[model samples]
Target chain A: MTATSPTARTGQVASAQPSARPGKRGDRTGAASRAPWLLLAPFLALFILTFVLPIFVAVGSSFTKVTRSGLFGEAGVKSEFAGFSNYAQALADGSFVASIGRMLLFGVVQVPVMIVLCTVLALMLESASAKWPGFFRAAYFLPYGVPGVIATILWSFLYVPGLSPLFDVAALVGLTPDFLGANTVLWSIANIVTWSYTGYNMLIIVAQLKAIPGELYEAAKVDGASTWRVALSIQLPLIRPALVLTTVFSIIGTLQLFAEAQVLKTVAPTIDSQYTPNLSAYTTAFAYNDYNVAAAQAVLIAVAAFVLSFAFLKFTNRKSS
Target chain B: MTATVTPTSTSASPARTSAAGTRRSGSKGRPSTIIVTAVLVVVALYFLIPVYWVVVAATKSTEDLFSTNGFWFAPTVALWDNLAQVLSYDNGIFIRWFLNSVLYAGIGALLATYFAAAGGYALAKYEFRGRNLVFGTILGGVLVPGTATALPLFLLFSQLGLANTYWSVLLPSLVSPFGLFLCRIYSQATVDTSLIEAARLDGAGELRIFHTIGLRVLTPALVTVFLFQLVGIWNNYFLPLVMLSDSGLYPITLGLNNWLSQVDRLPEFYELTTGGVLLSIIPLSIAMVVLQRFWRGGLTEGSVK
Candidate 1:
């Protein structure tokens, strides 16, 4: 299948080499070049229909509102220019503020822990003397392979009070801390996120580690400095780009913390309808059936994500530079 | 962590004197290796224990799950029996949900990977007008969370009369901006410009060059993107939750969520949901094992460049 397609095309093109030596050859070739366009057509059409057009429609619809007249309120409904009313209403909602606060807190707490854990794991895996580092690396990376939903579901079972073995162990120790309670629920979600993602970030850092020409480590070893000193000076500075990449991804993922909370909310009733920013938007859209409000909330979330991430990158870039 | 560091300079000392000296030191190696291996095993067990418990819990009836030991021990020979009950429960709707999940993720990832690869290849190789604009737009797209896009996409899909259909779920999955960004980066790193020019000089068409040479060198990235999109679509709950209304269209995540909601009413659903969760993981685990090599190379290479 692989060899036949390319070789046959090559053979045909090779055999047709000496066909013509006139202006007509250029014309024929130009017509033949259209074949590539034919091949690319399906992908282009799909892309436009699915991606490009939707954004345009969404942007346009965000500005409009549906209204009906009195005494014939149900008879005729028409789209009216609402200006910024929807956006204003969404901003006025209290849950939106709380959800944003929750996400900010999640980012503040989760991103740093994940980054530090990943860095430490990478350092351990990259240390020259560490035995079976590859085995450890793969084992650490195992959780990342599980789909996020499955990971959350699996963790939910573990977090469920009586069902979880962890809970059982806690009960045995006579220190049964409620993992899914209101006080620690956020952190519980954070723990799940940390578990799923720490290894993924570690792999990113390890890749950065591998690319750091071994000579640097060799040079560091030659110095009188200890392993900690070498890592602090050499490895940390070198892997800053990968660190930034993971940080940005972590920020985005933290903002979109729906699956974990949604699954847990079922078992742990303490998780309110609007536990996270995305959940707020989801409930507004689906549960309330308020499409206009939901659209407004969506735009607000996007703007918030954009500003926070953009500012973070700008600040980090400035400080680093 | 602190005690593990040992300076290699002393170990590299050339001598009978060093060998005689370190013969005593070598004896401690056994205890340290044991400690390290033990620590690693503990961590691995930490990773696997929940999954292990879920499997064991799925096998036992409700009575055994609580009555027997927490770990998977004897006294629960109901593995097949529980599986059968799960399959037949609610007129076998669990199986339908499983099939729905496979369709959403399996087909969705395939098409999404295709679009992402092609789009990424174009951005990497071609010099079209507005190239920077397109690329920058995609970069912007990468930063926008999918959850943020869900409402807008739902409204738009509803307007198009495509809501609650397969296309509703599949269409959004196909336009993964992050996957596109990765592919663009991967292609830029992997595909050789000189070879492309050479292929063009040999009178090969552009599409032919892309399929034959471009995708060949891009196998590693393609695999990575496929795995990423696959896992992503499989785990996707928010989109399916928002888009599909019919229970028949629910992916395993959403389906299990729906089941989890009703588990309080019917405790039998507890076993079925756990079993479904276990089954849901099999494809992903197999995918991981099959494609683990690609992940190492893909991620390592993406970072290095």
Candidate 2:
């Protein structure tokens, strides 16, 4: 990459050195040619402060325990190393474990449904004879603008029994729908997730679809291929990168489910404070006054997210290769 | 931006699409096209339904909010009344929250976009030592869940005496690995090295060249990164919820959620919550429609990398 860079390619060798080198991360170069370093400074500083430091702090704090001398801590608080105890405590809480299981189930069902919907939407909108793709695309994407809490608040109206026309119509047909029931609220949250993000994932796929060269489509038509054939044979395989990208994000998102479930908790009895792992860690730290345990739970959640994404990546990459 | 990349491409697609349209209509009958249109329409409705319900529900009075059907307007039109009540309800705190949101999201996304552009341009156009290390770190950042960073960040901010300040939220919103990734891809494909060299030879400094030449060609990337982070920060709840405890510092998301969490006790807030949700979404929904072209143009050009 360095060799192919334009300055290197043009052989704009520095007066004192080759390629001006712009130095390195810590070359302490003269003031003349520090453009790249200047450019990268702001992002690097904040990235380290907010991103790198947090992970280090969370991990470092997770290993230690804090004990107060008395009920009100009249004596000084003592701190000591406590390896793996916080993790054990986090796992021992059945609600915390249940939260992880719930998120896994949500992802297993919702992520695939959302990804498939996005792919289908992308393909259909980009199809040869598709009409009004622009209008339809905007309609699908408008929900992405609505914040998660707001989206749930709007959807909760439809989930409430007496307020919902959906339930009213169901009852008229000699049936009753319990959207906020303990067993059904999870799927209702699933419905909200699908509504909120399909457009976003679809947009990415659409962008990828647009990048597909017109020559391929023309050749498929030259071969007298049908629309379905072109979609299956060419479009599906071609958009795999976008599909994989959306799926990985969707999985991470499924793990970090907080605001939507929190908003739905107002109407649904099923949604507890620890209904999702992200919410669980939040409750642990703020409500239970257990920062170390919360940090451990957070690390576990991050591990779950990484594992899920890597597993999905391996599955997709292996299949393609 | 997406109307036609160069207008010449437009001539080819319609001809091809119409040809395909007629052939499919002939073989599979008109039902095929109708089916496609029907399915597209249904999906569009599914996405639009929630927004439409909000718009309708916002117009009714608090009493009508419950007695009326969830999907339609009730007998009385209380749109203005609801707005007045929500606006004046708590000494007009909602407006303060709205402005706070604008401050956090608008300024944060703009600075973040510029940083991404500059950082991305550096990564793409220059080769420095540890470049791979920087890029590799950012790649790992992409895989890390953003929320996990929030709690620890709050702890650190409090330690630094920066908690409850706007900087806590604004500072973190400024670094987006994904935006930097997109800008890098866009810059690599679009920025002309020959132009940069020529400008340099003419005695234009690096920053001047970047501003004049590099950023000119990087509009698609700038627009994409700006809007992406704008939506992200604007809709963000967890970070602000953790960082700021002051009501005055609350963004619309937090303020609205605060009201929502109280609706069970004060059922009258139902109207306020509905009105607030509708009002909050309007600005971005309009932007979504108006900027749809730039989004298409930006993402279409640079998504591969």
Which has the greatest lDDT? 2
Model 1, A84-177: lDDT tens digits are 9888887788878888898998899779877876786677556543457777777677677666777877888777766777766766879877
TM value for model 2: 0.91
Q: Which segments of candidate 2 are over 4 A away from where they belong?
A: A1-33, A72-74, B1-29
Model 2 C-alpha lDDT per residue in residues B1-305, reported as the tens digit of each score: 11112222322333344444343243233444555566777778778877888889889887777787877889889999999888997899999999999999999999999988988998988877788899989889998898999999988999999999989999999999999999888999999989987986687877787788888899878999999999999989999998999999999999999998888899888889999999999999999888877888898888755
What's the i-RMS for candidate 1 in angstroms?
A: 6.9
On the 0 to 100 scale, the lDDT of residue B44 in model 1 is 58
Give the lowest summed-lDDT range of ten residues in model 1 chain A.
A16-25
In candidate 1 the C-alpha lDDT for residue B97 amounts to 80
lDDT of 1 at A108: 97
Candidate 2 lDDT over A1-321, as tens digits, reads 333345544665555355445433123223224888888899999999999999999998788898989788788888789999999999999999999999888898888878877787777677645577789999989989989988998899888876666776677789887888888889889999888998998999998888888788888778877666677788888888888899999999999999999889888878899999999999999998889999999999999999989998999888877
